[model samples]
Target: MSVFTEAEIEYLRSQLLARLATVGVDGRPGVKPVGFLVDFATDEFVIGGYVGSGMAASKKFRDVEANPDVALVVDDVANIDPWTPRGIEIRGRAEAHTTGGAEIGERLGSAFAFDAAWIRVSPRRIVSWGIEGSSFEFSARDVASLPTSKGV
Candidate 1:
């Protein structure tokens, strides 16, 4: 079973961008908007860009190597008339990978393909709001507490 609910997964798949927060070696926090993909096979959020010489040198990649803690937020306004907003916040450990972009590329298709380094996040906690198709209150949970949470 997956850590995320079906509705959450659907929301995740519908969004292409997320705000990734990481900590620098000097103990500073940094957040940036990045293109992200959910790899259900491994149950991780993959963050990276197109295959390029500078990908490995990016700040986010460096931050992950120095510190594994990370948070990712994907959200948007769903409606104007109702003033509806929805989003998911995931806090987890992240690992920097120097390879494994080819598989991600296949899933992204040729136009947005990548063969460069990437970062994978294994969520330990999750918070969501406004996507349950009912109420707008936020719900938070510790993913590790769940029986099938991949023990994050």
Candidate 2:
């Protein structure tokens, strides 16, 4: 089953960056702009950064380690004159992994190093608006039940 409609999937695929939010052990919140890929097969969002470098030592990774709960927002204004705003908000649990020689690195393209670390987020809830007059929310179960498709 597909978690998103074809149009929604197309919108996601067309966009390159999203804002990822995580909470730290000290109860502080952090948000960063990250390049992401939507894995239609797993219905998850994937992001990678160089490991054993400044990225690995960054606070965002630390925050994810301390609190797996997170949120990601991908949005843009379609127009300025009439004011059409559209985007999707994803609330989910994130799992961090070392991407050494992992296929995920390749999927992320040449921008990411081969040994980069990555985070895969499994969404629990998704809310979307402003695409084709569509506005709705879906739970994980609801998403899982939708028919699956071949591409992102």
Candidate 3:
């Protein structure tokens, strides 16, 4: 009962960059397009949430704690042309960082294109995947959502 097929999930995991949109304490939805790595060739996303100074990066983390349910979307920008690659949407839970998960920061530090740290997100369910012509979708409750992971 998932929106994305096996191939779609595989494609998501293969991609290197995705937008992590988090709600700040102020209830504002903060969106940042960043790089990520899918470990074990699965849905285990270990990332770095480091970027910009005092931009309130921790705001996202606080949001995650306040609301564990999160949306992790990694999609290619749509171009006017028809032949460009399509985009993907993944819905999942974000694990807040801690002293133990600091290692994930280092792991994603080099894998990502950015010089700052990264935050890990585990997709419990995929919401959608498609190009300009078509699209597919899924949800966390759809298939029991993604299991709690260690990446965060």
Candidate 4:
């Protein structure tokens, strides 16, 4: 097993969006399931105005405001694609975007709802495993091999 190949990285971005967001509040940690839309164009994950944004998302925001450290797990539960039986867990810091935040300087986040912020993955570490048979693993760094949008 190795780090995510160039191809696998993009596939993961294009295929899966169901994410588990971990947020800690009042010294108690919680995991919330949420639907995220991955934007390959800018290599960013966006969450918008939706009702079932898991539990304590707003609270999580407050938590992030207090503590920037966070964790994320994005997976393909159906095993439908080549990377099927594979999931990636990212451990990194997180920051909540205010109306006039630096990166939030754009309108993308605030577009859909009052809380559309980008989950900037700092990529402290990446671990991917093969869920199919048993003996598979991968570790990937930056998306160096990712192709840019030329015609598309």
Question: Which candidate ranks first by TM-score, i.e. highest?
Answer: 1
Models 1 onward score TM values of 0.87, 0.81, 0.64, 0.58
Give the TM-score ranking, best first: 1, 2, 3, 4
lDDT of 2 by residue, 1-152 (tens): 66777877999988988999999999988899987888777788887765455555667777887899899999998888677778888888887665442476676453656345667787777877885573333323324432322232
Candidate ranking under lDDT, highest first, comes to: 1, 2, 3, 4
Question: Candidate 1 lDDT, tens digit per residue, 11-79?
Answer: 998898899999999999999898888877656787777777466798988999999999999999998
| lDDT digits (tens) for residues 11-122 of candidate 3 | 6656788777877667778876666666544456665544343222566666776666677777764454553446666567776654433455455444423324344566
Q: Report the Cα lDDT for candidate 3.
A: 0.57
- After TM-score superposition, the amount by which residue 24's alpha carbon in candidate 1 deviates from its true location, in angstroms, is 0.7
lDDT of 4 by residue, 46-149 (tens): 44434234323567667667676666677654445544466667665564554332234234433333233434434355666653233265655543423322
- Ten contiguous residues minimizing lDDT sum, candidate 4: 143-152
RMSD to true structure for each model, in Å: 3.6, 4.7, 4.8, 7.4
* Superposition error at 135 for model 4 (Å): 6.8
Residue-pair clashes, model 4: 6
